[model samples]
Target: MFLRVLGLLICFHVSIVSATELLVEKQAFSIDNFATFNGNVIEEVTVGWESYGELNEEKSNAILITHYFSGTSHAAGKYSPDDPQPGYWDAIIGPGKAIDTNKFFVISSDTLINAGVHDPNVITTGPASINPATGKPYGLNFPVVTIRDFVNVQKALVESLGISKLHAVIGPSMGSMQAIEWATAYPDWVERMVSVIGMAQTDAWTTLALEHWALPIRLDPDWNNGNYYGSTPPLQGLTHSLMLITQQALYPDFINQIQPQHSPLEQAPLNDINASHSAVQWLHVAAAQRATIMDANHILYLVRACQLFLAGHSGSLEEGLSKVKAKSLFLPASSDLLLMPYMARLAHDTLARLGKSTQYAEINGIQGHLDGVYQVQQQAEKIKQFLEN
Candidate 1:
């Protein structure tokens, strides 16, 4: 049983764990006439998925990795030797690393309305995707997607592979929400869940925080209420949104080192209102580079989906989590300012109080929320131990 459960958590914290490399391919999963929780229907839905290792005959070794809000299906490996970086979790998902692909079949996929639509590697159908009916972008016409919607799509992908149950579902940030949803919505399919930088519910505080991400995009003149598909895309608003996301995702301690702050007497910003600090300029350059490949509407839709998140959409946290049957672990970053650690603890305490098997741990790092990604190795053994026990 321990061996079986160990397969549940095999991919996370990419590129820093070990030097193992696994070549991977991005594949597609498509289903027609899919119905959503809101009674809306997508005539055709397609998403990109990538897998590592081999699936056992019984398919019990399968583990599904849900990507974060800013991530994609390429959980590990380089598409080619010349590619710059491996997938986000390459360090952990390789043949002999913590995920140990040699022992477990690992799958990770892009979600609906993924932020990286313009990136050639990402394949997802969203507002950015053209509608067959109109032969144009869906834009605002796209149905509101919920975290449950993401899980349902994943379930479809899993079933198409002839897998009846998952050894585990693991993810960080938004990925955590999807993992938790999977446990509640299909308790029988998930045996274990590891949520890093995760929360069982988006509280009132979080809902508003998520709204802040959408505010800039909505305020963009080019947005035109999400109607900028064929016209000039809302680059300005998208840039600001990305900037906000980057700042919120990192702690000051880590960010303080990224760019050196110039002295007031040395920089022109002190004398001129038009001039700005180097740090501000640095973030703008970075955000502009990233904005080119991201869609403004997709970011807004993702934010709305996150704002509406309530675990299984069960109306309340208690009712939503009451459906979970998996052994759960919550790992929140101690320095995180966004999605503060207490949210995870609140969920953990609730689960324990309800007699559900659960565990909690804090990852300490200077990167704050990003620690859940770059610093997960700090708790790799703890995760391995949880899977084993």
Candidate 2:
């Protein structure tokens, strides 16, 4: 959910910016009685998706781009010429960019509980969605979904389109976790995989760090045990959660450069105990903006999904990874503390030892985990080469 930090960069760079523009529209897909990992069923499920380029007659040229937390299927192009910017990965996903829409049909979709519930462009089913059975928002009654469940829905969508296999499955952060799961869950269906700032499993330390993202939302009085629907939503709790997430996702160096003194230009915090530092104030503004469009329960559900991540949902990571048939590329950011580079490294090494086809690289940047998405252009050439042969 932390991948949205790209907007904070003074200059966003990609391998190449295509001369021509890409225009796209959002679409929807639905599933019936989608079962959850814990044996519950979501009677009906729907998600938003958009794509670039064309699907070849053989359907062998299709590529799937799973989104990170707080992201959607709008992976490239603008819905209208008036848009402020193209999709998140526009740099490497256009006509002549790394993913190359010219040759491959690229598609991305929103996850089951995407955080962009308030964004007009996104359609997702989460706790806030209506429960057909009860005639009320599902709230906490929504079945707990896993990365595996997310993949299963995507698989159903792909099959509905008459595609037997994916040319590749690419994602960043939580997206990476899904990509890895795709490789293992249906080895024959996925031919290639690209995981940026990803790991094979969520360990104890990392899971605890993620739990902090959920704590604030749960502590809010308005949360009301996740049944706040049709009532006052947990705005304060969501804002604080976003604030904590933003702080944890970025690097100290990058933030220090933006606010070295951590104070307002005209005011000194020392003058009043009630005053908050500039960095804290900045977080307040940023987090408040994000919280307006985000749902507290959705964030809580996503945190649970992430914390429960284990590729293939198997007994062990090695056993799970051993099922992969896809040629894989691991691209962990050099400075990411959220999901350290070593996690990706360990996954890559495990695949190598298992005699699987795999490659590893690092994207260097100051955004820490955010770099996996914002600075991913650094590895565009490598991504292009890997996708080619």
Candidate 3:
């Protein structure tokens, strides 16, 4: 009886290990030296990324997981047993989960502009960081980038892994932007696609929100014209930026769940009250929350890139969207004020008219734009059923 009980326990553990969790891993890839976009030619580039599951013999089962503005490559499950935060989408990507590892392999990559200005743990190469050749941060000198540029880099990464094509490219918010771009930019590279709470073009309201988020950072005296590095860096600037963004990215419904009675700011008192109290207090908490965890410069870079995204920048919206040949799934969030559903509705109609296989579903959740993230379970199940069908 004892031996039988031990055997049963061992079998359960193996099953859990093989079918419940992903063995997430990381790798470095090099991009082509002359990858050009938006009228700029990058000589060479290296992108950092993480992968969940194993690529099959044919590499056709690969699923690309693009991340949002402040997100890293860590998509689902814990990086390590001692890691504090579970994978960003702990509920979704896992063995035997909605995006079942037993059937599909998953890959998520960190963008070039990653966390922090001076943090060594973050392997990011961006405008704010020093140019290895010049011994100076790229600063304002960094060449402007666009959504298409991001897709180009990802393509390089995918090719490096010997993946001739992708089964699906899926992401939430900013990631959704990349996913959409991937479908159009390299139609032959993907078989299917999914985008959550995003649109081909950013609305004016969305651009205004982004501008406001950048305002406080720009107003801070410590900004030092984007040259602050060694000394007291732009803590005030970054903090204010984070605070504004935190407030903007959230819906009243979502915040109400985390802090029922008051805002995250109201919970704490003003530190003896000063002229800079309103900005400092709120921005301080916001900065601290995102500071070490993410790079301010990277956030600004991605957001600025997002503002430049226009589905038809290369041609007419109809012509540009017509480039996509992959079957698509569009999940627009209900109450998303930033990328309004109207735009997504337009995209669906445009694609349908273009003769591409496309489907659009407005997810019914209280998360506003964040329905793409917070409601992943329902979203994942929907996707699972769709993909299976």
Candidate 4:
């Protein structure tokens, strides 16, 4: 019943966007049922997104790029040149690059996690934001949102654009979860998929790692069961969480090579001007904590959804794989301990058994999970070859 209403809204929104200009724009729409995986529903769903390139007459030449955690919809390059920070995948989505904006229409959206209060770039309406009705941040009151809910919102956005199908759906890390979900829920919509450095399910070890990341923010006294919006937040907790995440995401060799010799965070660096405390740390605890506090509940919800992921737990891995008729590309970082390359192998093997011709590539880079993001140039070449073939 809820899906029925949401479908109608999507049809209406697509009509509105189709009549307007192409390029990039931001808009809001309604999700009638908002059914979450935990059997909860949001009466009204709000999503923020940005787009690149032009939509074709048939709207079939569409590519969806889902982002990792701590990421926004700003993909390829910035909306304007004067912007302070560049887009996340500026290396690949340019004029003539792979997944070129000159050809395919690319869309990326901000997820439900709102980030923190101090961060100005993140425009999220999460737990720390506010409940329009009560005039306070939802905090603990924000219902738990699953990966399915996140994908459902994105599906609504795409459908609203008259894009009934995709040339490909590509994503890394958490974004891969959304790509996989789309394949399962609406298999007919995607023509091809690329999932990098992610798995069909979060293993127990991965769950433990995420719990550690969440622990620090929750421990802060200012967290106050997520009610400390107007007050000073728990800076220490947020920092600890970031540090833990940093340790997990980065390779030990990369850290060792940079720390003592060139980094400001190294214990030996003190007198040199370039060796200042702020030099090497692109991420600070204060910023991380605020981001965590601002989107604490949303983070919890996303993490929980990731935990619920198992290719076939909702049905069967084989069943889910069968739905994906799209010729798939599964690329997992060779050194990725978190997602692990073997998981991709499992999916590849299953798809093969189901008589689906699939391709698997293990990225041979020491950058760990960062390999998926940093080595886009190499990945893009591989992608170009795949798409061209």
Candidate 5:
């Protein structure tokens, strides 16, 4: 009996390991002279993407998962168990998790001008890519893109995969913007959607906030008007910009708890700014570390794109939203100051008033905007239920 029980335990362990072993693959698609919203054209554009699970014969179970700013197509599973971290949404995507890889075919892709282009895991067409016309880096020459442009690119990718209908479209933060755009742009194609910590339009406050993210990079001498491709990148300015973003990305209370003794701004008389022992130092270290691996031009472009985001660019918000035929779910973080729960609330209220099929819930967590991904488990069951319904 003891030997039989031990054998069963070994089999269980092996099954668990096999279940969590996920393979992330990168694929690319190209289009010639893709038109931009700004009326300009990219002579040649490539989109990078990854997929999980298998598409059934009917192809009716395909779900599109969009990425947030600074995110890649790696949304679930691990390249290796020893990896520092799994894909951003590993907690809620797997064989039996919220997204349920066994039941749905999951697909995610890197956005054009994606911020993590410097990272090996991501591929993007941005300032770093050489211009077909000049045989040099586009630098600032790359045409400005919009959320709609992103949606259009993904739409092409979807059609390329022979998928005519999406089981669902889901995302958080910037990804949510894409999901919302998909619903508005192709209402008949999407069956349902989950938009978390996002807005239908870039409000005045959000626009100002995005400007701050770009201001520091613009001030960097090495930025050289977005033409600094071969020279030393603007590490200092990028670091400062990321530092500013970090403060708003996470809850202040959470930061305080982590570094209780370090004040963010405690100055000493007759001392250099660097001589202070404050949480600002920690923020600087963290930001500087990240800035080392991210491109300044990419961040600037993405920020500009975010500033121009509107659910309905060519028409009124009501007119645009009224086009959505999919049942929707909105999950706003209770403590999210960056995106703010109110934005989600407004979308929810609008949909409710329209008598559209919708549900609204706030994710209660201490991580603020980061909670959408970091604390996703808290709402995983609810998400599973919604997806199943």
Candidate 6:
């Protein structure tokens, strides 16, 4: 009986060790002076990143995973097993998983102006970061950045690790833009690319949608022209902006099903003024909950950056796409209205017309644009096949 108990203890210990391995830790890399696509420069910049799996002797097995607009570098692990949430793409990245850790060394990084700069898990130089020149948070002084700037920083981070070439560069949404940028900016550095729910440039509709996201923040009195740091933030504006994003990020059907079925005119008892007895009220509450943790400036900066996203910043789309030499995979969410599937289809069509090696698939899920992250399993097999090829 004692021997059996010892065996059980050993098994339990091993389980503990395995769970610990999946917990993500943040790491930072710095550049002396990082130049922006706009010709401005940050005297010193720091980028936060996380890595999973091993870098083999050949160093040819590296994969770069880019994060979405609201995501961090913690792509595929837990902070702890007891933590409520795993990394955003935990579903598709791990040993024996779609982007198998055993065979590939995966790297992900927080983009400049990443959403949660104040969060312990993230580190980025944004409006919230101190200016080495002034020793105060940059606030509105932070130079505007573009998608190309994001790619430039990632290039520095990759090369710093002694990695000369990436086996693949993959991402969903904003990350997809970065992946495409990598292939276009340095075709020789990337071997394969996976662009999910992404486009070569922001469409007219997307640009208009992004304008709405920034309008609220600009109108908020507390915003004070983006200098509201260390004081009252633009909570109302931020929450409203997030509400707009949440409403659009998920499918209408999915949200309608989750929303309580109740008459819009129904009012709570006078004594219970705080009760959310309607769908709109519930949505507001949810948005507020998410907004409270996010930085308004970060979102504003990222939104503008996304609006300015052009695969070929200074050239025509066809000219930029014509430079891509990496084998590409394009996955569009079937129900996405935010970054519509048509956008992905256009890119695929363009690449095919150029006679580029590419594959196209649609993620048929109810999650809208979010299906790229939430419904990754639907396309896991295809991704594995593409990477293996």
Backbone clashes for every candidate come to 3, 1, 2, 7, 0, 0
- Stretches of candidate 6 exceeding 4 Å from the true structure: 1-21, 268-277
- In candidate 1, list every pair of residues with a backbone clash: 10-99, 14-89, 15-91
Q: Output the TM-score of candidate 4.
A: 0.83
Span of ten consecutive residues with least summed lDDT in model 1: 1-10
Query: lDDT of each structure?
Result: 0.83, 0.88, 0.68, 0.66, 0.82, 0.82
True-structure Cα RMSD, model 1? 5.2
- Looking at candidate 6, the ten consecutive residues that score lowest on lDDT are 1-10
Per-prediction TM-score to the true structure, in the order listed: 0.94, 0.96, 0.86, 0.83, 0.92, 0.92
Off by over 4 Å in 1: 1-18, 264-266
Sort order, lDDT high to low? 2, 1, 6, 5, 3, 4
- lDDT measured at residue 112 in model 4 versus the true structure, 0 to 100: 64
lDDT of 4 by residue, 1-389 (tens): 00001122223323322121123445455556667667865555665677778889988788898877655676556544454334556667656777777787888877765343334444455566557668877778878766677777888888888889988888888887777777777788878888877676666777787787788878988778777677876666766666566556656665454445454356635666555364235345334433543445555655666777765347777787777777778888887766778877888888889887688887766656766665655677878776656
In candidate 2, stretches whose alpha carbon ends up further than 4 angstroms from where it belongs are: 5-7, 10-20, 261-268
| Clash-forming residue pairs, model 2 | 1-69
Tell me, by TM-score, which candidate is best: 2
- Superposed on all Cα atoms, the candidates' RMSDs to the truth, in angstroms, are 5.2, 2.0, 8.2, 8.9, 7.6, 7.8
Using TM-score, rank the candidates from best to worst: 2, 1, 5, 6, 3, 4
In terms of lDDT, which candidate is stronger, 5 or 6? 6
Model 3 steric clash total:
2
Best candidate, lDDT: 2
* Model 3 lDDT per residue over 1-389, tens place: 00001122223223333233444555677654544565765555666777777899988899998877766676776656654445556567877677877778888887666544344334455776566558877776667787787777787778888998999998887888888889888889878888877778776777887777667666777766766666566666766666666555555675455444443354235343433433334435545655645545566676788887876457667887889988888888776766667878878889998888999988766546655665656677778866666
How many pairs of residues collide in model 6?
0
Using alpha carbons, what is the TM-score of model 5? 0.92
